[model samples]
Target: MGLFGSRGRRRDIPNNPALLAAAAENPGGSVAEIDPAYIDDPNGYVPQEAIRGSWLVDSGGKLTGEYEENPRHGVPQDDFSRLTDPDHWLGWLGDDPAAAVRKGIEESLRAQVADAVVEWVKILDAPRFLTGGRRHTEDEQVMLVTRAGLAAAFALSVRSTQHGRSTLLGVFSWVAAHLSEPQGRKDRTWFDLGVGLDWAGERLGERIYELDGTGGTVER
Candidate 1:
């Protein structure tokens, strides 16, 4: 017996009266009934690349936050002054820490040269840092150098992953000319780069590469 006192029969009814009323208003047909208001003009469609800024709006139709600019529209340049500013890096760090490290090195090199683009960015090796006589597992001392156009060097001490972003512990840069043979300095630059080159030669080196005709390097 069912609730309606019928034997072996069930009633198809909505518990909410409002739903029943709403269903009654809809026409019973194979094709779905769509509201004419939903048909939008095709010219209003905006492509992802064309969008530059976006503003946050609340449900009450009120402006919420400031306009945020799209970082992908231009060259990915890190603000030197805000390097240690954690807030600036929020969500900007890509998933791969190694790629971020390589970009940091390449950008630093690229900034120093004119009409020259940095390519074949690689992290030869990353040795862990020592803090107060104790090994800090998170920190890495990265040494990188550039060869073409001009010899530029950069040493980055970074936290591989800190609060979902790579924190820059320190950055050091110099021209390799100061350490070359005639200067009578320890030519350790070549030694360091030699090891990295040897390691890169053995494997398929994953590094930054420039697009065929575009002035910018491929992002990721």
Candidate 2:
């Protein structure tokens, strides 16, 4: 039996392993035939080099390409950066961007989620925001923000994923809990989350995180 907190991810990213490999770097790499290593262990390795349309990933999860002091590339080479570009939205959603706009989530909400993803990346990159000015490696930032970003994604999933109805209460509750964090407090775009917490308070008779009164939340 699995121990407490010893669990699998509700969802694994880069649904397509081949997509994570920068096949172009390998001369003959193509979507039809990606690196054999990725095929064998989709979650075990990643693109060794930066590719035009590839993501940086390893056994643990998705990661961004090398962090830059002055990144000038117009195209994003990693999952985190891709979040900011709507053009990549379709690829992120398995070549079906429209599908991402689902039952309880509208295009606007989807935009917000994407924005949050970008913001989450910045928060992760800037470790000093939480630790009072301490420079950290990109890996450290990824470790810190991956789960939180995924957790925030849960709120979006509550509206978009097939498990929305089943996970509605749980997902919103989880989101609320995260919204109480220092980073969450600093993020003002999550007004939708306030609406969600209000619903929880009105219906569930319980609430863990409350809206910040300083206009960071939209309580109705």
Indicate which candidate wins on TM-score.
1
Model 1 lDDT per residue over 102-215, tens place: 554655544544333432232212221111111234653522111101112222222112222121222222111111123432211111232332343222112111111112
Q: Give candidate 2 misplaced runs (Cα > 4 Å).
A: 1-31, 41-77, 86-220
Instruction: Give the count of colliding residue pairs in each prediction.
Output: 0, 0
Displacement of residue 121 (Cα, Å) in model 1 is: 2.8
| Colliding residue pairs in candidate 2 | none
- Pairs clashing in candidate 1? none
Worst 10 residues of 1 by lDDT: 143-152
Query: How much is 25 displaced in model 1, in angstroms?
Result: 94
Q: How accurate is candidate 1 locally (lDDT)?
A: 0.26
lDDT tens digits, residue span 81-149, model 2 = 322332221222235422332322333445644322211111011000111111235554432221111
The CA lDDT of each predicted structure is: 0.26, 0.26
